[model samples]
Target chain A: MNIDSIQNGVVIDHIKAGKSMEIYNLLQLYNLDCPVALITNAHSGKMGAKDIIKIDSENLDIDLDVIGLIDPNATVNIIRHGQLVEKKALTLPLELRDVLKCKNPRCITSVEQDLSHVFRLTDKQSGTYRCLYCEAKAERRN
Target chain B: MRSLIDILELSTQEIDELIATANDIIEHPEAYREKCRYKKLATLFFEPSTRTRLSFEAAMYELGGQVLGFSEAQSSSAAKGESVADTVRTVSCYADIIAMRHPKEGAPLVASMAASVPVINAGDGGHNHPTQTLTDLLTITREKGRLNNLSVGFCGDLKFGRTVHSLITALSRYEGIKIVLISPDELKLPSYVKKDVLKKKGITYVQTRDLEAVMPELDILYMTRVQKERFFNEEDYLRLKDMYILTPDKLHNAKSDLSIMHPLPRVNEIHTSIDADPRACYFRQALCGKYIRMALILKLLEIE
Candidate 1:
């Protein structure tokens, strides 16, 4: 497999192909004016298959928690001076705020428009997060 | 301070304290009107439960508190994929206390762990309804003028009636409290409740399908819906249902002091004619639910 190099940008690697768009939507990258190179069906010696998104001319204000929630395998590599300047692995946040809605119908956040939907990560091992008000489990949808 | 998470979390002394406090509130409502002056109670009902939610709101309002929160999931962020923990943390900031009803077991327990304020479990799945149990306790004490030495007959759907299980469990602690299980063979009380509660407490009891034969012996008749949905065959439901309906004619055999109670929104298990009878305490039971909740709020808030 040939490695593609970007002159100046950040590379999001190891995303399970086609999920890049979901990640894009989650990050709200469609609203950005910066050029985003979304590559799918890329070959990986390690992963057996992968996808890559190379965003040029802009650094992302991405939420690592959201990224970890969407796809835990993703890695972000920042490029400066044609070399990898920084590499960061995503971790789920201790608490999530206004990102995902609780599925529980009776939760206060479901009714109170002004209140932000919040969840506290209880068991990272199981990817279990509970609603702060109703104590409903916020299971990730595959 | 706001939510009644679990009955077990409360010690016997703590329960006694709440009961004593509830009695005080019942005796002197004026003294506690300012207790929760500016406080707000947010009832987040993920399930459809008008009775429990209304009682909770009425409880808070009676204590000079305000009420907010959604009654159904469609109206809330839950439909948008919001999580329970997040809702509780956020709601805690706005409401002084919260009452929650969910379809999942242990949901309120999860809320109680995350919430900064008090969290009450209105009811959860088929697991528990502590407030209902509390209301029953208050009603039994008020009606009988005591908790002990009462023969309480639990009729209709015993297997899935959360109220029956909770009330039986709570009543097991009092001395000389006898329980009579009245249900069809298919709707018998769960063995765990029998073994863990009644047998363990050495409480004497009997189980029978003959409601009329046993009516004269019971001091309290706790009636629950004999749900048609619980029956696999339509024929079986039709056969068993009419056997359970409490009519004014049936009360002729019952004791004059016998108080018939149902955790309401009753289907035809209880006939309308019985509502006019002095022995029908179910409506008053609803009022008791509010007063007990008022006591619960006052005790939980501890305004003294």
Candidate 2:
């Protein structure tokens, strides 16, 4: 598959395999008018299998921290005038607001639809995010 | 200025201060009778709680503060699908402070975020009940005469007992605090609690299935009821039903001075026979609940 690289855009690489669709939906990349390439099950020496999303738009402004929350291993490469200008690695955000919804049934956010799903990164090594209100552990998604 | 969401939010000194204030209230009730005269406390209980709700109302009333709000969800706008944030935001306009109890774990936390006044989490599901922890702490300090250097054994339903979890988290902060967790393997204390709080704090603790064996070693024995509602399997509940019944025969092995505490509404965990035992302090624990809540109300309102 010959997917063209963007002259000035962001290439999100090393997303966990088959998670490209989730990333696509979360970032609302489908709403963008620019050409977007979502490559799934790409063989990689580091990840064994990975998903990569390449967005071909200079004005595509995405919160890279959000990508970090969803998929921490993913890396973002900024293309400037067809050259790699920045290779940014993702880190678990210290605080997240409305990125990942709290799944605990007893969490207030579950009953209150208008409340923002807020979480604080309690443990970095284990990637533990606790509900800001109920302190319930955020469930890990496959 | 802040909310009491978790027991860990309080420092040992703050806890001590609260205990001291509670002790003062016990000695001179008339002094605090007019503290919260013009204030109002909104008790937004979205769940059925006899002791917690009443204790909060009693606390506010004891401070001469009026109490309002519903005792359950069906009576309130929450049943109509109003959010916790909106409920508290609206209640904040009516009351000087809010004490909310919900079956959901983080509901009061969501309330605290929106409310302009201080929010007190009365009880939130199987999550933190800081006030209960405060009540337990005050009870222990009063009964044992010291908070440190005590071998405390937590018995029965350690798994889903929010009181046990909060007490363990709080007690770990005190010096010479040794915890003996006595529960069946199926209902043992959660590993995250063991790893994050106990081990991280370097608090020496041992887990055992035999309650009788550890009973003799404890200076304080905190008993918790095995909730039938928490179990999905009926057979599992029946099988583990009578694992640790504290009878007079079993109490013989325990220390005479062992301060027996329970965040009550217990069902068959403690025999009625043990009620006469001098060590049984659960009733006193309940009374302490009211007093500590008064201190908490004063602290939150900054009435001192």
Candidate 3:
């Protein structure tokens, strides 16, 4: 790997090339003070094309389940003192809270301002989540 | 006593109580007025439903309650990215009850969980429409004077008709009810409804494409719009659009006491000429909707 090493940071790898922006927007990472490195269109033997984001700072709280939903192929690597400290594989959450919007037009969440648009994962393998309130399934788009 | 999020949660006695209350309200309108004098109803319609929204507002007004809330999603804070739970929680503080219509299938269920006040599901996407089911129940009882041993025909758009699904489920709980399903092959009732409600309940039913053939045998004919959008091909829509129209000629052989009902805002399914007939019960069905809702509001609020 010809990738530059980060002294102390978190590396998110194997994300789909163009979808890193969506993951970035979802996490609101741009407003943070940490040094962030976003690598796009990277080579991957399994994926053919990939992207990576390396954030250098203290341990930041990010919802990896959401990132997995946005790009399931992605992996997270925690780095410490220029060495890989911990590597964790991401999976979709059993119940998603305050994340995606239920696409159903008649869903009460779409009208009520006070309710958190929550969904419970009904099928993890198929990437199927049902709205907790409306039972509307939120399907993962490939 | 509170919000009605799912029909599965309502027992047989509770449904009967609601129906009885609705009937009482229909009979004596003055007795229930000012029942919820200082109360307010927040009708948060996330989708476009002119009929359901108006009915809910009318129901509230008839109870001497004020109505607030938007008719569409664009007019609400949801477009500004506010969450459903937060919105209901806020509205719960302002209104005594909330009647919401959302495109998402379980939206009202979600709102009910967060709302401190009673949350009524006016409608939700292609999912359940309990209120419509209640209206149908009230209509059938008032028209035929009974809920059981009747041959009911559900015609047109059975596949996407949430009201049809709800009605079938509600009626299945009763004894000796036979169903006649009339629709094009492309718009046959969904298998889930057939397997879950009709077949499981041991309710006898016959499926056909001819509406007139079944019209004479039916005690009640529930007509729904066969939308142009439901057809994938333009030619299929054209072929089926007029396939089930209930014109005067078709009603010649119909039962004398057969009540024609529609969960309306109909396009061309029912001819205007039939409106003058005694069996044309859709307009009365609309009024029944308001009374049922009025009864519902009174019951939920415990206003007697």
Candidate 4:
């Protein structure tokens, strides 16, 4: 199978297999009017099985922090006029704001309707994110 | 502008300063009578904590400041579906400082973010009660004459004991503070707490189920009530509520000068017989709560 190369867009490569859907949903790719292609279990030389997302819009601005939190090894290539402009590597964010919700039932974010759910990175090795309000560990949604 | 959401927010120097101020208040009560004159404190308790609410009220009153606000959520606009942020935002206009207690953890944090005036976390569910930790610190300093080099035993419901967690976190900052965690397996202290507050700080701790065996090893016995409000099942609460009753018989092996302290509104976890014992300092802990709170109010209000 063959997918068309984007003229001006972003190519998110090196995603861990089966995580493209999560990245797509978190990035709200469905809301974008531009044509988007998600290639799963693609062949890679460095990574065994990788997922890639190709966004066919030059003007689109996506949250790289979301990608960083989910898959730090993922790389983003900015394509301009069918040529790679910038290749960017991702790292875990120190703090996430409104990107995820606190799962603690007793947390203030659970009761206060208008409050923004915030999580702070506590453990770098474990990639542990704790709720800013109650300090409850944030579990990644499967 | 400033808030006391966690006990760690206050530095050791600040804690010492507050303790000194509380000691000064105790020695020369007349001098602090007009410290907070014309200032107002709002006791915004969304939960039904008679002791903490009254402590803040009494603290402000003793500082020559007036007090206002509701004791429970039913009496406040929270009953009308108003948010904590909105309530405190409005309360900031009327009061110089706000001492808020809510059943939802981190509600006071939300209040601090929204309110213009300083906010003190009186208590917030089973998450944190910074002022209570300060009270415990003051009580310990008064009883033992020092905060460091003591073996502190925390008994009862360690799982849901906010005071235990806060005090441990606070005391972990001191040198030579060894924590003896006494609780049944079902109500053991949470691993995250042990890691974040103890292990990470390199504080020595020992977990045990047999309180009697560790009784003599303790310098300060911090007893906590198994909170029924934190339980989803009544049967579990009933089974664990009476687990660690600090009867006089339990004190035979304990040190004669041991500080038997509890964040009060105690259930049967501590026997009424222990009340008359000189080792019992829970009542004195409550009084320390007021004085430390008075210092907290003065500090927050930046009063001379």
lDDT by residue (tens digit), candidate 4, B1-304:
5889999999999999999999999999999999888989999988888889988999999999999999989999999999998898899899999999998898998899899999999898899999999999999999999999999999999999999999999999999999999998989999999988899999999999999999999999999989899999999998888888889998999998999999988978898988999999999999999999999999989886
Model 2 segments more than 4 A misplaced: A41-50, A69-71, B233-235
How large a fraction of the reference contact set does each model reproduce?
0.00, 1.00, 0.86, 0.86
lDDT of 1 by residue, B1-304 (tens): 5457666566667667777778888889888787899999999998889999999988898889999999998998878877777888999899878888887666787688689988888987666799988888878877888888999999998986878988898888888888999998888998867976899799998999989999999999999986664455899777777668888888888899998999988988899988888888898888889987887776676666
Compared with the true structure, what per-residue lDDT tens digits does model 2 show for residues B1-304?
Answer: 8889888888888999999999999999999999999999999988899999999999999999999999999999988878787888899899999999898888787788789999999988888899999999999999989989999999999998899999999998889999999999999999999999999999999999988888889999999998876676889989987898888888778888999999999889999998998899999999999999999999999989
lDDT by residue for model 1 over A105-141, one digit each (tens)? 5455554466567889877786778876555678674
Cand. 1 TM to true fold: 0.66
Local distance difference test values of all predictions, in order: 0.82, 0.89, 0.85, 0.92
Q: Candidate 4 chain B: minimum summed lDDT over ten consecutive residues — where? A: B237-246
Chain A of model 1 scored by TM-score = 0.85
The list of candidate 4 runs beyond 4 A from truth reads A45-48
- Estimate TM-scores for all models: 0.66, 0.94, 0.71, 0.96
Question: Model 4 clash pairs?
Answer: none
Output the lDDT of residue A37, model 3.
Answer: 79
| Candidate 3 residue B27 C-alpha distance from true site, Å | 2.1
How many residue pairs collide in each prediction?
Answer: 33, 1, 26, 0
Superior by TM-score: candidate 1 or candidate 2: 2
* Candidate 1 C-alpha error for residue B137, in Å: 0.7
